[model samples]
Target: MSALHIALYVTGGIAAYKAAPLVRAFIKAGHSVRVVMTAHATEFITPLTMATLSQQPVALDNFAPPRPSEVSHIALADWTDVAIAYPATANFIAKIANGLADDMASTTWLATTAPRIVFPAMNGHMLHQAATERNLNQLGTDGVVVAPTGTGFLAEGYTGEGRLLEPAAAQDFVTYVMSRRQGRLQDVHVVITAGGTQEPIDPVRRLTNRSSGKMGYALAAAALQAGANVTLISTTGRQPPFGITYVPVTDVRQMQQALTARFAASDIVIMAAAVADWRPARVAQEKIKKQPGQETWQLDLVRNPDIIAGLGAQKTHQFLVGFAAETQDLIANAEKKLAAKHVDMLVANDVGKPGIGFGAEDNAVVLLQSGTAPQYLPKAPKTTIAAQVISAIAAARTPD
Candidate 1:
């Protein structure tokens, strides 16, 4: 991930103290932190304290203190990668939801195109109020991330669900959101398939491949960071990450069904899963126990659905990206599949190559599109490759 610059909004709440530690944590993790505290928030934590911790001037004024040419609110909002509202009170949440810019923080939020995250901390009753609930819902509907609150002792000497997450956990939450964020993909629905599908034979035996899902997962993460809503159909053994939809499948049929269900709503569909070419013709009712002296055992194989070709046959408005992992005739075979499957673009690689493809953390690929020359990306981190793919897709997309 690139180095991040954060605009941390501190609102009026006892949890404002937690924001102080969070600033240091952000700095320690090599991210830039700029604090923008509400006038009321100064009562709970001093602006001097926050500034000292963040090592930057606190933004407290609506306009520049010395140079009004620089609108403090808008400048800070535009400068940051993403903004976090720690100890976001119901009043402040309402202000943000309804577009009220009475204070510098609200005004900054209104002006920012970057992602906005709110960490609500208030009295339990205030948090539970219908207005607060409504504002929170509105924020989510508007694509803002609402961090979860914890139940703990409030400054009021009572335990409730409105307490802010601790500094450490809050830091992690910020990292998670930032890691998955990409402004280009914002609000765009994307679906991706990853890992090699498993075709079970008996209860204990199955056929699979070397696909680690790294490339596809990288694509999913990259699309997510680009601000696209993502759903991952994974055959990899790993669990899915938070914030995106995940559908686990073990066979090609399951993957096909999942893709069919999701493809209609997707703006882009990436077929990255390494589906099995064949499966057992008959699955034994129980494990096929080996005979003590069995010398000959035959297993029949059957062809699986050509998922990409099927989707391509009924092409729609969605941009389709297909991957070709070949051991021979790399470009020729890939182009054949691309044209045959009606793929909009093809990412082809030699899985047999050392240090690239399959389970490797890096990749080298040739990108082929309908009307463009082949674009070659040399070996690089999967995340970097993913960014390149998403950037290319964004460039190719028709602007709204």
Candidate 2:
């Protein structure tokens, strides 16, 4: 995400103390912030601290314009790319809901044309009050995005849902909201499979690959940022991003079932999972015991279903993409698979190298497609690579 100019409005609330760290979070993420605090809010968090953290003067009064020419509130409003109401109090929420502009913060909110977000922080009882609910609904109707509050201990010495969200979660929420506003894949449904499928050999043993699912998770996040409704069918148990459908599976059959259920409705499908090619012909219900005199053992194996190929054969309107993790003859093998699987695109990478692919933080891949020259993306962070792959898919999905 690009650096954004954020106009953060702080209102009077006990959660106002968190505004400093919130500003630091935005700055740490490479964004610029300008703070506007209510007089009551200043009692909780000093404007000087906000000014120091934001590296810009805090806007406290409607009449305290530094310039004699331009109105300060209007200038701040015009400069904003996104506006957020941090620790939005009941009174402040009502004022904004009713278009009441008594303070510099409210006036700037009224004047700004940027996308607006609000994070409510108040007593649980007050938050659940009919008046507060009505005000929040009104804010939503006015095109303000109301971020969900964290449920935890409140200032009243009781646990409730009115607590301010932690800094990391709050930043993630903002990122999601902004991504939705600027995304090109709005309303698109993307189904992605990730991680290495495990084939159980016995009660205590299993067969799997080196995949850690980092690339797949990165793809999911990138797809979400592009405004797609994403469904991630993963073998890993890691927590997914805030706005995606997460389906966990252990073997290729389970992954195939999950993908088949969502395939018809999906606009795009990415086969990023390192599915095992074979499974034991017979799995032992109990642990296989090693005979005292035996030096070696033999186990029969059966070929597993080719999950992505099945999807490719059945796909009608879906833009299917597959991954090829090769050790040798990367392009040759990937090109053959591209035709054999009938996928729209193939991402081929050499996993034989050390510290690059398969559980590595970075990756390099060559994009293969029919009737097009091979496009190589140099090694970079998985997140950057995922973004590039998503962009490539988006471009390919569009016709000339």
Candidate 3:
């Protein structure tokens, strides 16, 4: 690829140090680069260090002394081909998502029209929080590409998915984005089911699962980044990321109906929701009263609709992916499901495994393809896992 102009935005996170090496990589790749930092980011790393490494003076404030013009933000915004925000803080992410230009860094970000990418770094708990995840989804919807965070030691002394990407990985992602001639998944319509379906038994009582919906949300975000039109079907109360059309359902039947209506228009369907297997035989119109000695009351249950299998039966040309969450004999059970559902691919994980299952930010799964040995992925964040799944699906669709 020819040398291109690049702008690097640093945020306040422990991973800010990674920006130095990232700047070096872009220089080594024959690209012209400039560095910009949020005021809070300066507390983590010095401008002098980034300047020395990038061979360009780091721009900190929108209006610094001796500028030829007062609008430095506009000048910087207009000069870049691609802009990247590394170690993007949750605060900055939310601001960008909401179009808030409260600071120089955010103002420049808002002023730019170039393709933007964000590499988020934070504590695992913050990364998984409802608000942070929602902002990330919004960024994706707004056409900003997010590189998945890695798992490792955090400044907060905890370990999980909020670690920033290694310098090498971040560089590769930048190159891939800048070198692409055409967007992947352009004009493709993708429907993704995420989180777990809830089955209400009473006004307040319901049955749900531990699914956080991170994996499915990540898939939708990635699909949007790859230039695909995405529709997210979710049962979890979390909001869908910014770029997706969301359809929320509380029961398996409702989910089935939603999918049935959209499946024909979709080029791909990923059934990532952990739908309830059974539901109450009757849902009381009002809250069931608790009476003395009522603990012995019995309620009947019935099997819920089989969403994936139904889609598989009705699907003709669309690619279908299913997920299998198992406790024991994971592969064997997943293989059975693969055959039973006639899915193009099955991602199976052992939820019993520590730190790699439901309600956790990371997951270790095996991708199963018919007549081929299963491919195992070590424990990693759901975002990275989603990327792997997206790559696999793309490869499967490639002509031999």
Candidate 4:
């Protein structure tokens, strides 16, 4: 286990008392923790209690004297490996979401460069409010790991998803943030495809898959954090991280062309796009009208150009990865594709498995290498899986 330097920010909520136990858990896990309490949070839990548990003086204000000339907030912010806000109130959540820095807690959050996690706690109605939901969604999109609140009684006498996550779950999030391998893909170029390709059938009608592009987007973010320059080629409308270059394509042929043009420039290519396997033989000039006997109408379909196979055949020294989303004979089919496509590695998953494919945020996959037993990865957040995949790539590149 790595020695983690943690900064815990306590926000006002009925669950503020839970932060004490969390601090203790971190101490027990052999981490050095410092607690920062908002003025309102000090009402629910005293600084003495926290300082005693954390074995460090709790810094509650930006004006506090630092060990050096550095400001307390800035020093503490720099000292932390991961920062977390427990029992984040609706007001605090909005403050961070809107970039408000009225208090020490909010200011420290803005100053911290470390990965941040927030556990929200509030009244059931507040949690369900559209503004709150929007704020939470935005936070996730901004790459903050949020521990989902459990459904239970709130201090306001209502029962819903406003309770802070259990101590175990909070600790799990802390572990995750601290355990990530640092700068593993430094200076690498990663190209990824995402979402389902739309094959036009008419002016409006089209053929598409259920892919929501979560897996591909997650991979892009992970690779980016690992220090790789990422270009996400996606068909889904999901907005990628701020700095990544995104190329959107609506059909298989367009995607093939885009890949062909960009493949040689990328150091690593991950074909996560769910390109359509077939398309209408002839697209109608306009929307086909529904007639009384339209059930008898026929349409022709044709196979799409194989983008992955083309890249595989022409691939030189770069690492090429493929995704095999299968329902059955998973390993056998994936292995066949690995050989047929001449890929460096393949990620095979049973899409039919619950919570592992399509729009789901979590996934499980088997990493297939030529002549080696597939490495099984259990269902995890797409970000975690992406990091694992990138790590494997780095390992493969290491000299024997």
Predicted model with the maximum lDDT: 2
Question: How well is each residue in 54-139 modelled by candidate 4, as lDDT tens digits?
Answer: 99998887666666777877788899888899979998899898888877888888889888988888877888999999999888
What would the C-alpha RMSD of candidate 2 be, to one decimal place?
2.0
lDDT of each: 0.87, 0.92, 0.86, 0.85
Candidate with best TM-score: 2
The residue ranges of model 1 lying beyond 4 angstroms of the native Cα positions read 1-5, 10-31, 36-82, 89-116, 122-126, 129-188, 237-243, 295-297
Report the C-alpha displacement of residue 331, candidate 4, in angstroms: 1.0
Model 3, 296-366: lDDT tens digits are 77778999988898888888989999999999999999999999998999999999988988889998999
Task: For candidate 2, write residues 1-400 as lDDT tens digits.
Answer: 5689999999999999888999999998889999999999999989999999999999998878469778898999999999999989999999999999998999999999999999999988889999999999999998999999889987888788899887777887888888887776888999999999999989889999999999999999999888888899999998787777899999988998898899999999999999999999999999999999999999899999998889899999999999999999999999999999999999999999877779999999999999999999999999999999999999999854
Better of 1 and 4 by TM-score: 1
TM-score of each: 0.72, 0.93, 0.62, 0.62
Writing each residue's lDDT as its tens digit, candidate 1 over 140-208 gives: 999999999999998899888898988887875776687565377678889999999999898889989
Alpha carbon deviation, residue 61, candidate 4 (Å): 6.6
RMSD of each: 5.5, 2.0, 11.9, 10.2
Residue 327, candidate 3: alpha-carbon lDDT: 97
Residue 148, candidate 1: alpha-carbon lDDT: 92
What is the lDDT for 287 in model 1? 93
Tell me the spans in candidate 3 whose CA falls farther than 4 Å from its real position.
1-5, 8-56, 59-80, 83-183
